[model samples]
Target: MIKNFTVFKRKLSHVCNLKPYKDTKWLMPNGNPTGLFVYNCVADQKVPVILSDPHIATWYSCGPTVYDSAHIGHASCYVKLDIVQRILKSFFNIKLVTAMGVTDIDDKIIKRGKETNTNFKSIAQQYEYEFWLDMANLNVEKPSIIARVSDHILSIEQFIKKIIDSDMAYVTPDGSVYFNTAKFPSYGKLQKMQDCGEPLSVLKRNKMDFALWKGPKPGEPSWPVSWGEGRPGWHIECSAMVSKLFGSQLDFHAGGVDLQFPHHENEEAQSCAFHNTLQWANYWIHVGHLSVKGDSKMSKSLKNTISIPELLDKYSADTFRMACLMSNYRYPMEYSDQMMQTAEETLKKFKFFLKDVYVYVNNNALQNGVYKDKLLDDLQNVEYQNLKFLKSDFDTASCINNLLSLMSNTNNIIKEKNGEYYPVPIILIADYVTTVLMKFGVTLKENTEDSVSNSIIDTLVDFRHTVRLNALTRKDKELLNACDIVRDKMKMIEVQINDSNKTASWVFTK
Candidate 1:
């Protein structure tokens, strides 16, 4: 893990001699020339994601507010972010240390607690648990650090105090602290909005100024700060947590595009003011919204959500992940019946092709074939395209499209030889495809109940193969129909059968 800064620095010293390529800013730790460009929300253009230490990249992503069950819109953002993280760690070999903050102490939690007559902490905890479970089901990897505002209130207070000491923040008459946006020259750098330079008002220092600490409210959580008893504000929680974990600077800060205007902009302002630096984070990455019919963004507040559990009940996690992959990570993804149906069909196609190739390669022997050179060339080309698309802001849609083309081309070439595939090249293609898909959170295997079930399935496949062979020899059409019935029955249990003239094979259809 990249969590230990000492170990990271020790490793960085050895790789200092390796430099980035002349044409591109990004470089592999091994000094290989590679590139990864991401659209920086702050910069308003795609920029190279270069590693300062030649390997490690520090990232801070805003996490769920944890007042209710997460929805597909949340799923879209997390799954896509996980995809990018997978590529950075698995494909690019970048040592990524990601810290995600859970907004457990928010106004929503308080409001829900009051409505339900429950403890606010209990509400946050229950939903926080569900949130992690949902992420687990969606195959989102855990961040290097999971910071909750409740766990770091003291740090938050200290962070706010530092800003006040710097004279960029002021304490209100009600014992609340607000960030003085007018004092920060580059306050709206993230949103590219110019400061109004407005004078102080009776209620607030400026109209654009936001609270860093809200005075303690009855029935709400609060901690003692230097100024008074208060709770950390929404934007201040992320900034404080991020600064505590990653120090004065980090490589990346990411969240939903909806946060670009005030939330992320406020976070950037206070963080930069706290650090006394022009830049707190080098790259700002924002994921677009996930919308439903009527162009309404799916959100809990809108009551237009399909909860993670509800969505997973109708479709596998991989299906939802595939739906996300089919769309660009930086654009709105429409979650419609047609989108899900298309994702299911596409996943089925890939699964079927993989099953066919796996059976062929397993039962056959490796040998030279006429199209070996052609197939190899095709593999290299598709692999190149996969990397190219993924490197350019994680264009997973193009990567998946290219994989579809590879599958089609490979299937056609194998069919040309009457199922006589060259085992070596065929296995190579299968391995590569599986690797890429797995990185994208697509598990190709069905979750069988136990080893006994797997053994039974294997035995049944062999038994069916023998029975079919006997029927073919005896010229019994009735027995052939019985075999077909058995195969259809297997489909009910999510097992697929692939039959050849002499033998048959089976794979789980998850």
Candidate 2:
């Protein structure tokens, strides 16, 4: 019956080890290793991860509320998660499908709407567009799906109905539906609520209980549901969307650590109730918060936030990405102009090394065998260390340090080359170095046309040297005239380079 059986042959795949291990390379080198949360299905008593096979691994991130433009703190979470997705694909060789949900309906959205004297939908759309622009400027990839709550009201209602039918949720006298906290015993497991003080909310029967849907209020976004004209609460939006898009079980759900509490906890409760199971996700990954000026957390309401667009306008996106990677994903990063300046200087060194390697490789007179194998070996080691650090729970800081070490070694090797140079293999090394920097979103490409023009000027200086030698030896007026012409061009190119560099410096300083 099966004629071409060879066409249907299955390839063997490696199984992922799930056993927990201590991460000695954490931020402080010996800090308590972060733990992963896995949801166990009550019905089958097994974790609900997809069977080991070829399929798109799903990741859902809690996106920003569109009431305000995104800031560096918001960008930090997205950048860390972006690296996670990249490593999953590059290192583990896994297929990934990621999604982010915008909170278009929330108390904050309504408050912002009233404050701005605009309709809720208009306010949401305007900020949502601006958010997309900011993400574009920062070069953050768009999620596979960007579902807005306003676009999925019916799905939200269906999810609520399922939970209500399961006796896990109930509508109060005001038509607000609340999840029964006592129904789920593992409600506070993610954040280890027992160790923390009691929750602050006293509105619910249980201190851990949170809203599933809020009753309608005047001048607020509302949807006609079975309960009443109201909207989904902050936590329920993510739960409802995740369940609708990826079903009740997901491979990974991520957000900032600040969300592990009421946000993710409530999502777990609502999803588990709907599925009649204990697990909502296979792995819960939370990126650490970004700090500004010492250890103070950056917040918009606190007026200590840095806008993404504003930062990009000042510094290259590559510099910003480098600064973010300088800190571990799960640890706090203190942001300062001095840090960014340091990142810029570091990037310049990397660029210079890359160009030198390129020039050495392209030189026809250079011999090849001297540093080729050593450079290749060093590059491979860097890639290995990067994977090791990332697999140990996305230890970006250590991974970056390893990369820097490789770069330093490669630079030394290039510097020590005094014999016949092989330009081809050296160019290959430069290409490899550039690719590695690109993985972290750092570009060695000069930022302006003027910089490119200045490099041309530097090359012309060598040409002028040749021309002057010809003029002196042969007494050629043509060669002398050509030297003068090149001198004028060099001056013009130098001026352009100086002006561009000054502009870049001023932008960052301000």
Predicted model with the maximum lDDT: 1
The candidate scoring highest on TM-score is: 1
Whole-model lDDT per candidate: 0.82, 0.67
Candidate 1 clashes between residue pairs 3 or more apart in a chain or in different chains: none
Stretches of candidate 1 above 4 Å error?
1-34, 194-201, 364-371, 417-421, 448-489, 496-509
**Local lDDT at 128 for model 2:** 93
**Model 2: per-residue Cα lDDT over 66-159, one tens digit each:** 8888899988888778777776665566677888999888777788888989887888899999988887766678899998998888988889
RMSD of each: 6.5, 8.7
Cα TM-score per model = 0.85, 0.79
lDDT of 1 by residue, 82-132 (tens): 988888888888899999999999898999999999999999999999999
